[model samples]
Target: MATEYLSEKHLRGFDKYKYNAKDTSPLSIYVMHPFWNSVVKIFPDWFAPNLMTFLGFLILVLSFILLSLADWSYYASSRTYPQHPPVSNLVFLIIGVGLFVAHTLDGIDGKQARRTNSSSPLGELFDHGSDSVISCLLPIGVYSIFGRDEKDYGANILLLYLIVCVISATFYISHWEKYLTGVMFLPWAYDFSQLALVVIYIITSIFGYEIWKGTYAFGFEFRYLFVLTTMGGSVVLSLPNTIWNIYVSYRDGTGKNRSFFHAVEPAIPAVLLFVVASLWAFLSPTDILQLEPRIFCLTVGIIMSNICCHLIISQMTETRAKCFNWLLVPLMIVATLSVSTNLGSLELYLLYCLAAVALILHFHYACSVVVQLADHFNIYVFSLEKRSPKAARVSNGTK
Candidate 1:
């Protein structure tokens, strides 16, 4: 039966396959769009799509830095979990608003490009690349808001890490689907999840961080239950959906069995990073959270960023997904250090610095790929004007 379906779809030609964008969120359609469309209209003719992408990323980075500083201070004071966050309520408010605005700008960049007649694959790469970084940062910020203690070895800590992994996996799979079927699937959960983060910030701002630390009707910690449910839902809902999508694509011949490596290759770095971190956490004498809570977050953020970078590069170059092998160096170093001896504060600091360097290098690769693709396509990264209209025409035809 599978062979018959594949044969029929092959005869039909994969070029006939259309990319589908699915979004069922009423909040996004009824509430967000009305407002977002209005804001897009106000964007001046000269406002470049890539600029909006970069600006949104800048705002998210600022929020992450503030949150990290606050978290480090709280950890340094030897504060226990379930306490109020050390940051001011005003900061939470600002972070919430900033994230929302970032989301807004990200959503409209394509429209801005279309309006300015400057749409290119580079615009898509920039938008997704920024999103990849923001995805890691946003969850880390939320974890800090919950005042999660990384020092403790418990189910809750494991769940927290699992939640981060699940988020990254969903993102990875989404891009994998794009690689396979050439369609970007926007699940309803994606938008709602972002809104939920925004709501968390608002709640922290109004009722104070103590609210998140409190128990709910079921006598479970609210944050614990939230993370548990997120992990559970991904396993229950998302995992199955992803499998079904792959199956359908194969049946439709939009995806080829010979290209399975293309779908799985981008995930190799992420998997390796996760395994190395897990080994380090288990083997080290000192708890990773105890070493430096912020460092753990940074490690996770960098791994996710590496994964995102690989996805963007693969898309831009139209090649099989490749891992950022340089990232493995720090992970291997940390893993080796874990069982060798107890790492002092100085050693931890050095590790943090190394991770930061890895992050910078990963982003450099992403940026370089975008520049090369832009130059090849003859489109300006920050302008509506094409560098070579004839080249652009030729590229469009090839695409």
Candidate 2:
């Protein structure tokens, strides 16, 4: 039926806005419309299949709900029941699984959209946008279980990093849109990063050491060389894949702001500070027990992750017009400076406010950017459908 409807003769005669037809291409190929045709064909008369964009949003929403419920500190139970450390590991494992599951669902909506020829800007926006929330929220949810408070200035920093992710993603997408002919959006790799982090957490929960440090012959204390190495390596490993995605997105024709220099942007000073601080920790034996490696890892991860977030948000064409985003670095600076100022209560209050403000702004910007991106994609898809004879006919029939 779709073939007949999209046939050249019919397309030549058809009014673009007045008719709708199906594009009977293998429904499997489109990421956004997974199972739509099969579902529709199985019960064409009884049920309407939602577009992949809708499904992706739905899954994202559900994932957030699940994360909200999964306490990161469920591992505390292990502390109480020493004999059953496995319980804590199990709890953490479950949370990790939930995260992975959410990540998995992340791709389905895109797949579904493609299969049904129902791809839209909203779908693209929603699919990518939810990531900002998930990225920050996942860490927060996990950290909260680790005894961190939302009020912990660090948590707020994580949220700030989340904003960066949104910025970076936007930057990546928009910049690429400028140069690339089509979206080279490797939705899989992006999703895989989240999955790998979950695996990292699982490793942490199962073994206190970050690496599989075996006992040295006749040594009283277990050597932790492997753990430190892995943790360091994981951080490094994460950086390239992330940068690759950003590079691909920036160079791709789909994004609009294409500058070679900008593509190789510098690490934010804050990130450099983190690297310095981390290197300092590793180099100075005095800082080891005082600044726990795990805590250091988490902090550095939070900072670096946010850097990615910033790059993601930068991908968006419509974001950061407001002056407030510019304040993020200064605010982070202020918070860091407070530790040195010795202003006691004043420092604490100011840091608190900075974190609170950053979190609110980050989420606000992310949500807004994602929505706008979605709208733009929707318009683009609709325009393409209206302009393309085959697409026009298919769209009309669908309506």
Candidate 3:
């Protein structure tokens, strides 16, 4: 079948594709997986795993939408903003339930695929590709609980930006490691973080967001603890482990075994993302993030997801990863314009435009890649059914 976004090399590599990974997280292994095993049983075999993945994605979208309705400027729960009303407890409760259900569905899609013998590289693409986007949404949703009021316990834009960057980077690192080592080492923080966020949402729902409006005994805010723990876990545990595993792969002569330059090549797009995002937020003439954080965050998420989806295609098909992504070109342009010109009130409009462009590009990439894969595999994306082969036309254009 003809393809776009995937080259002939990628198409060829899919014939030999196999998923190899290890999930050694105690929470994932002992708790969530078993829980998911039970959960997947509740789904009839006719239900497709990709449907579960998409449903989970939609649930998160709903959560984001609900929060956006209440806290469009992210001042909903701000102690500093006396005029801004608090987010509805009902909304938080709904978000909590949505997050839990989405997390559960995310956990079970693979097992469901196996149960129905519907597993394919497309599953990985859909699942993890969706996850790259989910990685950003989860943080932005959680940000709604505390918000961007730096005067109080809420995190400032830069700190929240840092938290978001850390989350997306850690996720990309997992796949980048796989790109280099040819095995996926699932992160331990995922299950634990989701559960913890659920707890946070529940606590916020019950006790009100005022509960976190205080400093810890050590004089630091409780909000900083999230950043600390997140960075601490990655630095002390995951980062070191990833480095060691890649080192072992190279030393033991078992990995892709490319030179140092090539080994780190896949990270270029992400680095550019971090640099441009930081400059845009930090140097915006209009303080774009404060004006509209959700748009900025979602734009980053969408672009990051696009980069990640490309990496996923490369990893799944065992083809070469891109050194740069075209999605970043417009991003760089927006960042440059935001910084170089005194756009004033117009800068916010520019950000909205950037977000629109990002969404369009990401959506096009997603649809094109999924359709290409489905056509090449002679299978449906959100269904277990196979497609009838396309009728061939000869010189006369006759089937």
Candidate 4:
């Protein structure tokens, strides 16, 4: 399989690459490391790292499905009359727990790999790829939990769009930094953000969705405040660090071609995704908030995941960075339809199906790059084998 992905020459070329992990989060150093290390100590030696990665992803997918169903129920019930159906507290609790477990499993996979002497670049790529998928889903789950209101359609869609963009941008910036510096740095926000999201889920479970819809201080609803703070604060905390890192890299001669485009190119996909989504919302016959909102959210998630996958592949293959142009086709189709004819329900459904297909191809491309890299490294995706005696000796000598 690996041979099908990469040639012998490319394999030799990748052998020179080394990965560096630089995490400076206090929460990670003090809390997560200790907790994860303890968990790693108890993990069975036979556990496969890739399996753990897949498990986490599967759990998140289950959570997504559950939440989508719950959201659909609310939408269906509301369509008959005016009020949203009361969602069971258990639904929220279960979803929250699922997300928490997914996050834990995600963290544990790396430690499991290192403990079992199975660490490889493929493992790292797999982890990030899974994370990229989850990042998009997380916001969608949050949005679904807060049932949509007809009155707030404009604000709701706009906020959701902004949240998605921010999440994608932050993720892109992190990888862009790695592309420039060779070191992957984890900030404090990265450590706590997942926990914060987990807490939000739990809180929603306990208080119910209505609690978030209620007014909070500053004449804002609790959900809006939460979204604003979380998304805005993340941008505030992360954007500066990204800029400083780029500046430092340029000053030290580590990064060449210090240009604005270099700093902003990685973010272009997210920006384009936002634009596409916005155009869809503007052009659609029905309000985005009134349509199957979960589907729209899912579409955004898939597009964002596609972008993340593109960035990862570009970095892995040492190719020039570029946004996924194929994403624009759906947008263009919708745009043309809006001008030429009103999009009926069937047309809209077909457009969504097209977007879904695009997502599948995007993900496939990401997986292909990973497989090629794994072949180059002579590592199996699901298993780690001991190096040859001579190879081991060479590694030890290098150390």
Candidate 5:
């Protein structure tokens, strides 16, 4: 088989086979319309064997993140909105299921790419870009839908979500590029962090005052210390990805003069604030606890700080390359800020518009590549297959 040189520019036009080369080649597996094939090609069977395995690792990482985040949020919401209908817990369940579904679909696209042999640079560009956007937006959207009316509270939740996502993605990307090169990166240690948080949440939900009674196991309250531990641990554990990213960036001559150690934000203060909030809550009676505006207010502040941290980190790394990962932050902020105050309607028009634009652009670049490849090969090989001297020369050499 003759090997062809594929350039970065040709990614949008790589789907065609030889004009009259018969159906003997593997490329024929993708003979359908370039546009449709590219769209369908993002499944498991399309991925090369190696890529499929890597995709599995990513799916697991994503699953762990989903499970931990869901558990923590559910525990918090249970106490934070104790008066809301039991139906609210359904939202957390739905998010958990959604994560699983999204991860499964994510696994398929790579396989499709491999099975059809339609893998191209632009397809990759779209896939990674989509994941980045979804990672930052979905959580924020959920928070807005459920907690938007809580004034700065909802806004804060969305902000922190944005921050963690930005830092995590940036670091993961930088780390993967540095360590794995051709393989997808996995943050295995991150699972431990999530596990730790789940434990903290369980303790907080059950005990309430053990953390701030200042006697270790003496007063043994579950209070706000629980929220602090979970949130603080989340931020602290998130350091691995960020630190790895910074290390990679600096080693790659990209970090310039940025201080590595200085980048570690003071998680202590935030953790302490959470402790104070928890103590206040613990001292209050069960009934009053439900009405405390501070419960929602402080939660929002923590979330907002998280978001701000991510934005700042993203902006700092703007000129360092691969800056598109930050695109969701501003868009998410805009959407959250623009929603109706009552949350009566879903108002998904903006979401729909964004999804459509991304899809159109993703497929447009892919289809153009495949179609162009078909055109080029059709003229080059099929037109003069028997007549061209070079064809005979190449054919003879093969034998």
Candidate 6:
């Protein structure tokens, strides 16, 4: 089945695909976009857009892995646990530099594609596909900054789960909205969020993570203000705007204009993702979330990224979206076994197994899709060149 990830139906849809997006973000319009327009010029025309996309993702992963290793329990900076030894000030600097470079590369890939005359649906897919993973990783890394104490500063384990879900949902829905409406309603909050996080990481690098602790106004911790703003941007700004854009598209007869049920079909998998992860965390006999927050977050984020990838494929190719995601079945079984059956260490092992499976499936899917598309499109995914004519002829004959 993995070999057939893209069927004839999907290929046919891709043949007709054209990228369309609406980005009215003041930041993107007046600031980042212009900066990217200039920054992209520095690159040689030989630079591949997909290379930038993939490299940026790798940089972010490097920073995330290094930070996780340094702050495994995510309390290295905790005032309440001084013996935990604060994350080296250098880690924050690494993350800050890494994120800034990654974010900049992301902003310019599309512009680079357009400049090099290499624009295609494949580039968008690669860009946002990596983006889906970054969506989860960015927040999980930020959680380490605030640390895991609800009263002193950082959010507890449960709240962090919700934050990851909310951020992932906002991103997934934006793409899903495109599936329904045929227009990507780019969120203004995205640019601000990335820049803000970079600034925060930089601030921590200079002044230490302790700056976030105990600062208060109107009887609430300042860290909670970040939490409220993050969640609020999703529930208040991003989602409502997405719904409105979809509604307008349908009302004006510009969208796919399917029935309500069909329009909402893509949401089932996304909803189930949150449900399965929540059940596992909330019902775990071992208190998996609190006892093993890092693994839990990584597991859930990988699963969420896989789901988002499926959604992107559906939207980009105009293929019928899945009403039920396949990963949910196995994940649900894992959750059930962890909670309903007594397995002691095996439960944590099950969680490990889940993360492993999730990671494997995600990579397999990403790699297969990229190879398939590269062959079909007669292009290199990370190089500014076309495939050999012989290979292209063979690819077209079969696929």
Give me the displacement of residue 222 in model 4, in angstroms: 0.6
The order of the candidates by TM-score, greatest first, is: 6, 3, 4, 1, 2, 5
TM-score of each: 0.82, 0.48, 0.94, 0.84, 0.36, 0.97
lDDT of candidate 5 vs native? 0.36
Window of ten residues with lowest summed lDDT in model 1: 1-10
Task: Please list the C-alpha lDDT of all candidates, in the order they appear.
Answer: 0.67, 0.39, 0.84, 0.67, 0.36, 0.86
Best by lDDT: 6
lDDT of 1 by residue, 125-243 (tens): 67887777776677667775655444431234455566677777777777776666555656556667777778888988888666765567778766667776666655665566667
Residues 252-355 of candidate 3 have per-residue lDDT tens digits of 98888978887777898999998998888888888888788888988998898888888888877777788899989988987898899898888888888889
Evaluated with TM-score, which candidate comes out highest?
A: 6
Per-residue lDDT value at 29 in model 4: 89
Q: Which of candidates 3 and 4 reaches a greater lDDT?
A: 3
Clashing pairs in 1: none
What digit string (tens of lDDT, one per residue) describes model 4 on residues 1-399? 212433343344345445676777778888988888787677688788988898889988888788777666334212333465555678778877887777778878988987888877678778888888787777766676554454432135556666866786688778887767656776557667788777877886788655555566878866567687768767877778877876788788775343676656776767777776777666667564346555666676676777776666556545556745577567566655754566667655766686677677767766776666654455566766654534322121131
C-alpha lDDT of residue 377 in model 6: 82
Error of 5 at 327 (Å): 7.9
| Candidate 3 global lDDT | 0.84
In candidate 3, residue 240 scores what lDDT? 81
Q: Count the backbone clashes (under 3 Å) in each candidate.
A: 0, 66, 0, 0, 40, 0
- Candidate 2 accuracy as lDDT: 0.39
Supply candidate 1's per-residue lDDT for 365.
Answer: 68
After superposition on all C-alphas, the RMSD of every candidate to the true structure, in Å, is: 7.4, 12.2, 2.8, 5.0, 15.7, 1.6
For candidate 6, what is the lDDT?
0.86
Give lDDT: candidate 1, residue 31.
Answer: 81
- What are the per-residue Cα lDDT tens digits for candidate 5 across 62-151? 543544454334223332555442223343344445444444445455446546555443334334444443433333323322232232
